[model samples]
Target: MNAPTVPVLQVHQLTKSVQLEDEVLHILESVELTINPSESVAIVGPSGSGKSTLLSLLAGLDQPSSGSIELMGKPFHDLSEDGRAAARAGTVGFVFQNFQLLPALTALENVMLPLELQGARDAEAKARHFMDEVGLGHRLNHQPGRLSGGEQQRVAIARAFATQPALLFADEPTGNLDSANSQKVEDLLFKLNAEFGTTLVLVTHDRELAKRCQRTLVLDNGTLVEAAHASTGA
Candidate 1:
């Protein structure tokens, strides 16, 4: 008999709000979701719909004002900031729109940083392998400033996948790139996911990107409005 599947990510009654002056601005309200392992999911919504906020909370990068998030089976709300950081180590990877590469670090070094932090002795080899996978082996020595937007993003993708995390989160990963580069990045994301079986959760406004996911969640007015065709700009 097959065992019941345990969700890789779980969110129940997730809500987030902040105090602005004398007013309380609610950013998210009763958001609930569950994601199984190795599933590719997209989070999409209009501006100010809390897509990024939801991503942050799910990734344990930030805590929600009133909610609990279970990521890879650990309750984030129950952990301290340092505890959450410890939990995320080696298990979660992030790709960002800005590339987030260190200006002074070469592509190789930037990709190696996370592995080194995790005390992997083969950091160089792994970084090299992922760089090659992303078609940037020749650009290993190039600094972020010396690389084009697409190349830098490719490096970021390499960095994210080098750790072989169980879960990957990306926030508008191709937003800063041109259409050509965007397509390249989009391709790389699904390729890596297929190759690694990494559960992917992305927050993107790109309809094409959303369509590529196995499923999509539409966030509107701080709530999830389930849709059958999320890529249709629902």
Candidate 2:
């Protein structure tokens, strides 16, 4: 008999809230989820539904107010800030809506940054390979300011996957792109995801984008539920 595979991410009663003037605003409440390795999942909802907040907690970028998060079988929620950073060093990757490329760096340098940080001696070679995979090899010498929105996003994608992380988190990846560019980025994102066997968890308001994932989740009023179709509002 084969051994059962462990889930890539697990959450239990996750919650987040903030203190306002004489009030406590709840952002998330008792969110429960499990994601297996190599699965593609989307989280969508209305504005102020706390989608991005949940993503941050799951990625261990921020601490939750309550509940535990297990990422890649480690107690992510229990770690200190620096410990969490250590955990994500090579195992987790992220692609954000605003291409977070260093403006001064060339496309290839942006892609190579993470690899170099991880002490990979062949950072440039790996960066070049993924840059070519995203059809951005020709623009490697160009800086982010010199590239179009689509090209910048493609560069971000290359940077994310260059680390070959076990999991990836994308926050409204196509939010800043036009329709045509959105479609192109979506294609490249899924293509690289499949090739790398990386588990994907994304937050998008685009219904079509959500539908492309194997599973869709809805976040509403600080709660989460499985969804057959994602709502395209806000």
Write the residue-wise lDDT of candidate 1 on 55-161 in tens digits: 98988877888877887777876689999999999989999989999998999999999999999999999999999999999999999999999999999999999
Q: Local distance difference test, per candidate?
A: 0.90, 0.93
TM-score of each: 0.95, 0.97
Segments in model 2 whose C-alpha atoms lie over 4 Å from true places: 229-234
Alpha carbon RMSD to native, model 2? 2.8
lDDT of 2 by residue, 1-234 (tens): 988888899999999999999999999999999999998899999999999999999998889999999988779998999999999988899999999999999999999999999999999999999999999889989999999999999999999999999999999999999999999999988887788899989999998999998889999999999987643411
Clashing pairs in 2: none
**CA deviation > 4 Å runs, candidate 1:** 230-234
